[model samples]
Target: MTTMLGVLLRVYLVLGFALEVQTFVRLYVLSTPIAALTPSLSDPALDNVPAFRRLYAVYCISLGLLRLAAAVDIKNKGLLAALAIVHVVEAAFSIAEVLVFQHVPPQALLDEPHLKTTGFLALLVAQALLFAYGYMTASTIKSKMHEW
Candidate 1:
């Protein structure tokens, strides 16, 4: 179980690093306007650019650090705990955006892309499961440190 959990942590680490790089390129190097991106492609919570940037920074930092720690201490309880906390926050924010802004926005402001409600709901459920998995893995490692 510990080995499996460690593998999962590494996977999360890769995802975190990829997201950080992509966001950095989009926001800084590319100088791409966030609004120009398809609204449906990103979480509507990102509608507020400043807030989104701040939250994204937090996500990137926590994920990068935690993943690196996991690599060093494969069964590190502290790293798992930190990662669980961050994932929970991200999952919540993503879900909230879907719920609060699922509808199409005004055409005058930004053209709303078509959304597959079922697909969106499925994605939300998947995110929730991922968060739960992170929480469980962290707690399990803490409780059964030797086994892991």
Candidate 2:
């Protein structure tokens, strides 16, 4: 008898894990071609740095693993809370990178040929929504309770 929140959280966690793993693969294994194809979407300073790309890939994979763990143990409140916080941080960093850090101009974000920036921003928004949903779901879980 899993609640709707539990089901949603599980789905979100699984999706997040898949996306993170995909990001790791793209960033590490296909960095060169991706960078060449989308120079404007890449960071010029770290684009050619293999070490940085690998480090980022590791980070992405680690996050994916965390999401996978949380998805498996969906009744763990602590893990859900941590994942919510992680999602918040990820969304915040992405927003900062685009707005505060000026990685991409605010006005030019949606002006790209293929809507890359638009997709990036939309993903961030989705992550933010996931964070809220995760937090709510976590709060609904009781300590020492295993079943959702």
Candidate 3:
């Protein structure tokens, strides 16, 4: 079971890294085209904020690197725990964005593509599952260490 969990975690990490890198490229390198394609995804207030976009790109790339490292060394309990925390924090921020901050207007929500909303919900669930898996993997590793 532990081995299976580790394998799943590794796969998730690699996929996460790929996604982060893709987001970084889209946000930083292809911002204009991407924004044109998905105007609803872009906030008009942030249009003039190039620095914010660049900072976000940097953040995405950093997360990608961390995910890559975690995937390479799945047995590292500390890394697993750190990743778990990251996932939870991200999830919390996302929740706060939509719920607390009202980042997405209620009336405008109906005008957006259903696929986009579904995809965001799917990502949220995946983040939660990843957090659980990371915690389980780290706990398993700690137990095994004591068994030796």
> Evaluated with TM-score, which candidate comes out highest?
3
lDDT of 2 at 101: 62
Error of 3 at 77 (Å): 1.8
How well is each residue in 28-141 modelled by candidate 3, as lDDT tens digits? 887843344233333456647888778768878998998899788777767777777776776666555554454665455456553465356457668767666776667675
Per-residue CA lDDT of model 1 for 1-148, tens digit only, reads 7556656656666676666666655755564555443233355445557766655555555566666666556455566556556656655654455456655443322223434433444454564465456556665655655532
lDDT score, candidate 1, position 122: 49
lDDT (CA) per prediction: 0.55, 0.69, 0.68
Cα TM-score per model: 0.56, 0.72, 0.73
**Compared to the true structure, candidate 3 yields what TM-score?**
0.73
Q: Model 3: which residue pairs collide?
A: none
Cα lDDT tens digits for candidate 2, 5-105 = 67777788899899888888777776754444323335677776778677768878998998899888887666767777776786676667666665556
List ranges where model 3 is wrong by over 4 Å. 32-42, 103-115, 139-148
Against the hidden true structure, what lDDT does model 2 obtain? 0.69
